[model samples]
Target: MSKKDTTYILNEIRNYLDKFNNASDEYYSFIKLSNELSELRTTIQRIELADASIPYINQLKKQYDAKEQAYIALYKYIKHGLISSWYETNKIIKDIGKISDADLSNKNKQMQYLNHYKTLLQENNNIIKPTLKERIAYSLSNLIRKR
Candidate 1:
């Protein structure tokens, strides 16, 4: 996919939420958001697996990496408090053991899990968005391992 795809998808989500109106439009918007998020997830997987020696592909990858970081920062800025609080996120994990048989059918429990899941997405984005030093170290390790 083009480098702009993910950024555009994220911006679409942000714009929709910012201008959100008409409760009647919510159902369709939610469905569209779900599909876009699914697509974004797939695009992320592809970005992670992409490998190339060509200069153009390498350049595109770097641009995508930068864009991803910007997109994440913008998302956090725009959707402040949309992600669950860190304490709640941690508490949910702790409380999971109290859940008998991991019953997800309970709407309240399910909402907790969903919030926890979104918190994880935020945390995972922070963790996985590699820094230049980390990326260089990874490249060196790969080269060493191949020898």
Candidate 2:
């Protein structure tokens, strides 16, 4: 798993906590699921329209399944009122961090692919439109290089 992917999730959860603190009805998990569902819906539609390969469709389906499970779990947790303050939010963040950390460690057990992916992203950004994506790519690359 990429740092960006996990960091995006963490930032999203933080946003939801902010919303909840402001008396919003939306929970972080719910918003996360909604965003995932929206993304998956678009991908699924595009794949179907293009008559994508079976293996790719199967892969998307597996991802959809995983997101569905996460949504359900989050729904139940929120339903039980697990979130109340920063204390509760930190616990939830730690749970997600643990899973993502484990995934990253296991991925690195084969070989650290972080630099390779970052390089590819930079190359793509160099060739593509210099929009927000490119700006983020540039910023993240700089941050990574600094470390």
Candidate 3:
């Protein structure tokens, strides 16, 4: 990688980290929102077959989907940056392309885990409902433990 590319990749990594933190917050909020939506949907389904409240539920679902897409994109960008940086630092002059090809295979596996989590969330939305406050506390605890 050129020096400029490397710098750009580093900045991208930082941006990804920041976005990841924000996504974590959004994920928690989405969980709460999903729970509320689930309850509302259930109530609406019970009370009336067709109602205006359905749109609210649909809107929340769309917001959750958008947030999920953003999270996936940021995760891919960060993982790509990491692997590309690693390959650039370690590969032989003539083997850089091969290195990237191999690394991308591994990246695909990493993404599989991410996709699995996404699928799990979609399948059992209530299985992972960490409140925003709980997420913040968990993050702070993890940061402190790292130190």
Candidate 4:
């Protein structure tokens, strides 16, 4: 491979690694948030039992349940992002490894390789299918902002 082509692959790998790291960080955040929310729900349940006579306690319990479900859904979305990023990173490394053994000295061959690389990136982009929870969260956020 030419110097430029080698540089391109190296840069792509570096950027992909950064993305993978970020996704991992977000995944950790999601876990932390989920745990905290679980604790909050437990506390709420305890309170609901202690103050069962409160007139609005049932409504409060229902809202708390909805919030807990939303957090669980968000956790799923972040976990999905983490797993997909890891898979894509591994695939990128493998693809780059294969490139190192190929002949790319000819200009036409180099162009073909570049095109193939673009196609691979496109495929990776297409794999980020949003979960239903993610779509709903986005919709809710947008609705709130419209006020």
Each candidate structure's TM-score, on Cα atoms with residue i matched to residue i, is 0.23, 0.38, 0.28, 0.53
Candidate 3 residue-wise lDDT, 4-53, digit = tens:
54345445445544655765675576566557656655655554556557
Residue ranges of candidate 2 with Cα displaced over 4 Å: 1-26, 82-147
lDDT of 1 by residue, 30-125 (tens): 455556655666665566577534665566556556656655665543333222222233444344333344343345544345445445545654
Best by TM-score: 4
lDDT of 2 at 115: 33
lDDT by residue (tens digit), candidate 4, 64-120: 677778778877667556555645655665655555434533466554565466456
Which residue pairs in candidate 3 have backbone atoms (N, alpha carbon, C) closer than 3 angstroms, thus clashing? none
Number of the candidate with higher TM-score, 1 or 4? 4
lDDT of each: 0.47, 0.58, 0.48, 0.64
Model 1 residue pairs with clashes: none
Greater lDDT among 1 and 3 belongs to: 3
- lDDT for predicted candidate 1 compared with the true structure: 0.47
| Candidate 3 positional error at 74, Å | 1.0
Cα RMSD for candidates in order: 18.7, 19.5, 16.9, 8.9
